[model samples]
Target chain A: MNNWFKILLLSGLSFFTLGKAQEKVTIGEKQNVFSKVLNENREIWIHLPKTYNDKEINPAKYPVIYLLDGEINFEYYTGLSDFIARTPYADIPECIVVGIKNTERTRDLTPTKSQKKSPVNPEVTLFADSGGGENFVKFLQEELKPFINKNYRTQDYSILVGHSFGGLFAINTFLMHPDYFNAYVANDPSLWWDNEVSITRTKEYLEKNKKFPAHKMLYVSQADNEEKQKNWNSDMTQAIEKFKGIVEKNGSLNYKHTFFPGEVHGTVSYPGNYEALKFIFKGFRTDIKQLAKNPGLLEEDYKQFSKKMGTEFFPSESYLNIVLKFMKSNDFKEPETYFMNLKNKLYPKVK
Target chain B: MNNWFKILLLSGLSFFTLGKAQEKVTIGEKQNVFSKVLNENREIWIHLPKTYNDKEINPAKYPVIYLLDGEINFEYYTGLSDFIARTPYADIPECIVVGIKNTERTRDLTPTKSQKKSPVNPEVTLFADSGGGENFVKFLQEELKPFINKNYRTQDYSILVGHSFGGLFAINTFLMHPDYFNAYVANDPSLWWDNEVSITRTKEYLEKNKKFPAHKMLYVSQADNEEKQKNWNSDMTQAIEKFKGIVEKNGSLNYKHTFFPGEVHGTVSYPGNYEALKFIFKGFRTDIKQLAKNPGLLEEDYKQFSKKMGTEFFPSESYLNIVLKFMKSNDFKEPETYFMNLKNKLYPKVK
Candidate 1:
């Protein structure tokens, strides 16, 4: 090839790269999973945490959060997870969020083949294609989990989060297959399904097991559905309260139930999810200021947190770097050295 | 071209288009604005609401939210706004979020030349490059706002949101240029800047005017900052409380102060921003069930809300569509016709 032609081609390629300079800010990627259990192709939205791609740190495994109602919640949920998982005062371990988009909302979420008269129109029925909740859970455990575990750098610990009918699915999955996920979150769940079948399941579980499982966490958020003002003792509100009463009485499961007074059924998930994460990872945040005086406290805190969680978690290189920067800037020389050693120990040099 | 060659070219073009199908879920776009006032280029992140590009609806105008700390807060804030503004249960109008990325943090956000000894290390001084707040606001007012208005379909209503130093800037901006935005949100603002200069400014304004602007709204959120346990009356806490007292005593501005019991400075903004939007658009939510019985109630509620806001806020076409769907499905023929007429009146068909 001519030297001038080669130079022109190289210049054109450089221009194309420059033109492709990212104009849109993206949060997650779309991955299609063919689910044999459901006999369908499902699209999953995957959002990796900030440190997942950081070259400065060694490759790390992250807890996976399986979120239901992907299209509605994925955008905010991903951003919120990253925001709360920021270093130095991290509230939770950085985790990958897998948002499962719904193809058959009623079919995949309802645990039983039950139909209800629509609130607006009694002639019209709701949840006609229900009873596939068990099937959906099977897909998650058998196909989706393996796909995520195979493809991503993931930790053993995982969380299942859902709202409304999705929330019902989370609780049912927890009751049926307790070992599948480490923690469960149900936000304004449709616990009133089939005359409160969830309450019956809870009672049965306690009767059979004598106590809820240890180390497994459940967080349920109940919304103050204003409809109760008009129809006193609405089934939706009553069912949740009954479940809360039963669970609290049992006192074996690590559980937290928050009732947001002003929040409606549609909006309770925002604050509920935040509180759920904090509850699930209760001891995750370590004081950066305290670290200046006592560097060893970092590991001690993590040790205590891990013991409570029944999972192993270590300080990320990114977090250690943040701690080191704080210590160095604040003139805590000994602490700075301690963190430097900690970072090296946790994330060894590649070469 | 030959018939075979034409078919082959068409097939290749279709293949290329299919290969370029969307893989990443995007929330916003990045736009760089040249600010002659500041003599620099500023990158702005812009997030449009869901219905912005819907072919089914006519082009509509939306309120814009000017968010500070663009890099840190833009992603979640946009998502939160969209979530809250979902049709049929919208707590606020759909909004366009414009997040201004920082160039020089301390230089642009602080109101005056200010310096403070670091809490961790007294040898280091903070805000050395301060006092450019006025200039930054000038750039926003003169350059950025014009660029946004010229480019996008915008409503007259706009909100200013900020956190920490950015929060300080929001409060200062509200006080100095009250008419610039309809609402202001300051999440855990650095009210203690320059030994509580914001407190002095608040007092001075109250004394001079005896009342704040009638329609403008301000929402301030104070974090619990667990450090308060160690130092009961820290300057950060004291300054914020003092400002709150002065403003509340004056009782002129549409103001709200929320003390988040467990939220720290770093994490308060997530919930704070959510509450701030709710506070600003308190009367925006209309009951779909109520509308089924009283079709005229929608317009009445909007009128009352508009009167309170001192701005005209018509029912959005998307919202009207949702209302129509509810009425149609519920067999409320009269209400369905009423909403269809309302939608047509508000947003006429282009043809």
Candidate 2:
């Protein structure tokens, strides 16, 4: 072969080698476009899982978890989600966690502006330009949703999780547009904002809106509060009680609230987010009673359930045992028999 | 002054300024020497907390969590521990985590060697050099422990956590020397090593050794074995059941076992470690039921108990709430009344 021909062949071989090398998951930066109600050039941080490219038979689609305060909480949430989703009891499906970067948190989160600076950081402006939450919601609904839907094989269900100001935004969004998300987690929301204006608003909204959708909401509070001495805890308690009381009066609204008494505002988000995720997507009935009745259903049947459920079901042996426990609880004659049945249905030749 | 003296003075000032600039938590390689047991030549990675240099009257001794696989898991664990500890639960005290580097995992982890190759990696030789677990434990007990104790203002309580082969080593150490650590978290231990030799050894140890100390042990496993079609699930379940049964029989042993059903052995460690830490150091509680009936005990009496308990007692508002839960469960009439009596005895101002 001529020199040029040889060079082309070599280059081709190099390209193939490089492609193979890049096959494994690369942990770094990726540019994402955001064109909601806001401006055009909004970039997002996307962390692709380890097995993003290698498998060829069937492409995997991840459940999307939209987190607010992308800049500050991205690494944390991503690391945590990556860690916990891979665990046993809280085996949430592997997800594409889209950390929505914050440009103006106050403007986007706050329903109404209160002329109050954060007590902790007096110099730092809290709400320079407030009451842009409606516009922000529009951005998420119109632009962001369409973009994500068009690009990724996203399931119908999505989770919105946030902290403090971001927490308020999540709650407000859930209240205003219930259909947008399947689950909502609010960590230590600024309930003290505008003398509980949002709480009052929540009460009014619940009263007017009779049809509450089937979903999950987790409210978390930290122990170290600046306003604790001045009844911040009682104020938050009263607000939550009032909200819960109203929901009770209406006799609807799927939600749970937890107080992280020993946790501070800054640190409560991680564990709260973790527990919230676990609570929301708590898997299908693995209880013994349900399984024992359907004795023929084998391991393969559950495996199929996992596959069908997609990213919502994090596959785990412990989870299977949990199902086994449920089965045994219902006086299932043989745990091994059920397992064998599952195995035969799922993979007859193997094992 | 002379011309040379003037130049030297200016140079000294410049050097001082340079020193100030470079003083902020210097990263990279450093040789740490603890005592005669540890060689000074060993490279150490030290991270001082944000408040390390703060000027405070009563500088607190931070709790330390020593981790295996320093090179890989250190940064992640350190960041996580710091973040969570700073949160509201204050479940475990804010700990300074120390990651111990490994030279050879197989050599360090294994207590005995068998001439066998890994089924997955038959081409590569396995278990060639093993039985270094004893020495590895000694290194921690003698060299590392003394050095850390001498250098840092560390609390008496310490945690030992490891994963994979390292996890096997951690369990081995815990089994051998329970007094060395307050808590032990082993994630995805290699139970299938040498045809379940470790499992056999554990069974033998439990049967023979009747006396078990008071410490926490958390073992975690994952779901990847099913994909490999190995008996990974059975192995995990058996180990868990056996361990739990042994602990239950002993009554003196405090242990918990969790299986991450779908999680791969490689990825289950992180979440398992976090959860294990939380589970282990839940809190310090004393049986106050006996004192409850004595109505004559003044509020000042409770203050004495608080004073005696010192750092172990709940100081933060949220922790107080948890204490209240404990109190209520023990049939205490009112948390305020109970706490008031305790506080007056232990802490006058707070009561």
Candidate 3:
């Protein structure tokens, strides 16, 4: 064999090993299943939270986040999950992330496709296959969700996150079928789809529905790049703003509209998703020392947050481990013993 | 024995193989060498730009970027390089990225050992044996740089990018050895080393040096997270602002200080590096269609930019390919022939 080829093979082996050698590993399981609705096989990447272990006797049931455009976006979101949910801070609650890779992105992410091309999109054939967004949502609802619930330890609450055309599908799904998810986050949604077909539906939905689903939230973000550029005409921002206005006019709708000024289409996902998740878990605090000092307050806070979020939201074993990690870092001594004993006393082992 | 463990092993294999399948990939060759200065085997990751092997006729010599804390951060920086240098827009010029992984982070990154502890750092014992930074710089100069130059196709121009303690090292190296790198980017540099030893040194250096090396730049960034929290005491930002003020007062120093308002110390590297590289390549344009229309102007621009950068710089072949890619996207016929013909006529292949 050629030297470069051998070196390449050896490096490839090292890359996989290096990925696993890290402590807070983000190794995801990829599974393929045939979808009856879609009439094709779909590959899904599912990342379980660090706390998840089937052997730990009724370990934990986590809320699921169904991330659209997950083929390319999973790695970044996985990093976010490792930091927010699994890291020492435990800044956000733990949840399983289900990243759904796509076969045809345009077919699945647009509500009603049109032949009309926006001046922003020069490629006329880009939106050729239209009107499959509703079916895609059905594929999620009727097929994917049931399979996940059947196989994994999942809670009742779930979140739907999307970007660009995926964002359009997320918002459209929320409007068309409001009870599908607990929260819907759309980042730089392609509202220009089908001549703003989804935006028109949003106004009509607001006029008729009078109130959105209980304990549900919707967030829409617009990249400021389009608005700043002279030729782009700011259509995406305008459509999103118009949607936000309609939601606000409804009075009972829980909605937020964000604008990332310096971010363009490609760069919006990083900050956009970070801010959206922050908005979702705005009240969760991570200072272990402060929380430890006021145990009663911490208890009350979790219970109240659980009630608000419609999930049993106590700190997971992994979360308590991080707290103990801080304690050990501060020279409190033998954090392993303290946390283990406390875990036994507070939440006894099933076996 | 467990099912999850078995699944994990399979996934690991899949991940590595998948990483291999991609063409013109950013597959870094990791090699180790015994450094006499450090008295240990040091690992370095060298990523050749996509265009390096595209055309075999003595392909381009790229500027090297030495990234500190490369073990974990290399993946992110690699993605950034792919986007900025290899992507369609080619927002930044293509260059080789050399990621330097650490053996003893504290020993090498800090300029001096300090007994004094900040109230924010709970672990007082974290900074022991912390005065090896100068030696590390020596190792880079004597061993690493010589090795890279001898082995790889690299320009004399180089950049040093570091975050946190590594940032401290970057600034120290720039102050002590101005000719080592053409640009220094310090993202949220921890300037509280040895009771502000480096900061004091920075003040004294600026007073004497009169002017920074021509065309060389230094950028410092402060994140908002440290400022918002009560316990953290906002020292990083304060120190950075003071340093920025000192450089500004020097007048002739090429300096820029940026603050990511909503970003924390950990989260700052992504946007910080992105913005810093943008600042470095602010004048390099990649719009190929407009450039193709006036080919003479594009050639002249590269020459002028090369002169300004104090290095021989030219748009890489991959950069040209992306231009033709845009042309192909916009209904321009036979992009390959035009680009090939243009490449032959304009930049004649080296014998």
Candidate 4:
């Protein structure tokens, strides 16, 4: 073989080897966005739903979930959203999950500059760089959201999710800027931070506003980490209960508080996030079998759900395709035709 | 530039572009295994734990879990395993997840050749190529298991996990070859197959063997999918209840059965799998704070757990390192020294 030809052939073979070496199962991609508010390069993990790039379906917009503590929760959280949002029995609409990886976690998520001596070693100080949450939210709202909106097809609806300090940030954001997100989920939030400053903020907000904004939802999950908490003289549980009481008493906010008995602070987020999504998208699941005979019920159900959510949610083209296939496979001609017409009406063919 | 040089430079640039185009968050990789027993090529998705290749610690062996319905469950299932298995408050040992993708779903997961008329369309037959489960298990035992064992750093302990027809296979496999795996998990098993053949088999096995084998564990999860079941005249719930009663009455097998409310047939696997893992590894969690003051208790707990499990389980090098770091950071000198000794005793320096 000629020298140049041999070198080129070798390079080509190496490329193919690298490509086929391992067929990976990937959940998302990592992208960097420079936040001027935080004045740092922030890395975000973005997971698009399975059908986001499907050529068969028309381009679609999706609700974006901003998940805090990205590196920890990105993998399972993304998987979960996709799993439950499967068509024909989708509990929630397909979503885009944007996981924000932390740089200085304590600095970013805390609402107040407070420090505590380590319980195990009183000589050591903790949370030395606390209180940058307000600025963090500003970065999210001003910089990150715009970047996401510009790059991806997204619905106006979005959610904020967090755990522990992240959860505290989420609650603070909800209280400070209620209209920023449609819903908020806080799992085992560190409400006891800075001697329950978040509780004070919540009370002040309620007193001033009289009521939480309609159509905004908040779901809080408290973990039964009693055994773990016993090690430190912490009022985490009490703070959470107090917040729960306040929220329940107010009765103006769409709120749900769950106490997971067996879950610890670290593990609560797994089930907590799952429950939060179900609670937020409560009316999304429609029985496909029921739809066979009562095809008109689909539209009626969606209308009622939209009215309740204060946001319009039509059936996705992908979901319609799945429904159509189900009806056709079952030989339910009437419903099959019904769905075909619905699909055509909602997503007309382009000339 | 010269033509050859330009071509080479272009190829190099293209390779770099391909590499940098997307930084993906991957959970696992896919591999093919030719199964002589089933006479076909089968694909498997393999997920290794985070510390599997960490150069900081010695290579460790992990318990292997063979997951069924790979296409649907692999992603979240892998994440769940890794998430819960984090050190210091780890609920279960880090595991190697091998998800077997389907080839012929009905044929491979069903125990007996059975057919049913589609409830929606009586003209159509369901489960046409049923009853290849025995062969499928044979493939696992002879080909797939060996391939995995050969390729990975695997512990002796292994688990079989499945749902629906796959769940039926797990149960059937447990009855036929209890010695093959250390634990078995069945999530909403189709015990009603062929007029409750699994129930009959369960009875016969109890009659012949007198009791389930010792040291082996079985976890069963039943979904309260009554609304879905109402569409088809199914004995699924009854069969599951009957099996649960028989197993509990036996009083010999290490078993647990849980019925998850509000979960449908399609969505049951997520929570079911989560509960199954927790149930299987109930005594794995230990308090890191408790270990700080009384480090000797760690070995005592492990000893007790090992005896109960009928298998020895040492703290991994990674876990001991975490403990040591925790103690050192907290200035717990005695416990830090104790764990250092333990680490040295368990995973000695090669040099």
Evaluate every candidate with DockQ and list the scores. Answer: 0.31, 0.03, 0.16, 0.31
Question: Please, what are the lDDT tens digits per residue for candidate 1 over residues A213-261?
Answer: 7799999998888553445226778888888999899899999999998
User: Candidate 4 regions off by >4 Å?
Assistant: A1-20, A231-234, B1-20
**What is the C-alpha lDDT profile of model 4 across B1-351, one tens digit per residue?**
343443355344531121134578999998755555776656789999999999988889999999999999998899899999988779999999999999899999999999998878899999989999888888889778887888889999999999999999999999999999999999999999999999999999999999999999999988886765675634788899999999999999999998888887788888988988998888888888889878998899899888878788888899999999999898899999999999999988888
Best by lDDT: 4
Q: What is the lDDT of residue A232 in candidate 2?
A: 30
Model 4, residue B160: C-alpha shift (Å)? 0.8
Return the lDDT, model 4, position B252.
98
Ranking of models by lDDT: 4, 1, 3, 2
Writing each residue's lDDT as its tens digit, candidate 1 over B1-351 gives: 443443354344531121123389999887655566787657789899999999899998999999998999988998899999998889999999999999998999999998877766889987789989999999888777877887789999999999998889999999889988899999989998887887788878778888899899999999987563445226678888888888888888899999998888889999999999999999999988889889899999999999998899999999999999888888999999999999888888987
Q: Candidate 3 lDDT, tens digit per residue, B1-351?
A: 343443354344432122111112123667665566887767778777667787544467788899999875665576566555645545677678888888999898888876556463544755666889999999888878887887778878889999999899999999889888999999999886666777799778766766666788888888885654745636666778778877887777667778888667776776788788877776676445455455456667788877777777766665665666666566556654566666677567666
Q: CAPRI band of model 1?
A: acceptable
- Isolated chain A TM-score, each model: 0.92, 0.69, 0.84, 0.93
lDDT of 3 by residue, A1-351 (tens): 443443355345532122212122234777665566787657778887666874543477888899998766676676565555535445577778899999998888888857655352355555678778888998999878987887788988899999988898999999899889989999988886667888788878767876776678887777775633545536777777777777787768667778878666666766677677767766665556564454345567777777766656776666666666666666655544566566666668666
Against the true structure, candidate 3 reaches a TM-score of 0.81
CAPRI classification of candidate 4: acceptable
**TM-score for each model:** 0.93, 0.54, 0.81, 0.94
Model 1, native contacts kept: 0.46
lDDT for each residue of candidate 4 in A326-346, tens digit (9 for 90 to 100): 999988999999999999999
For residue A211, give model 4's deviation from the true position in Å: 0.7
The segments of candidate 2 whose C-alpha lies over 4 angstroms from its true place after superposition are A1-36, A39-43, A87-90, A117-128, A150-153, A215-233, A248-251, A284-351, B1-79, B85-132, B135-159, B163-168, B174-272, B275-351
Question: What range of 10 consecutive residues in model 1 chain B has the weakest lDDT sum?
Answer: B13-22
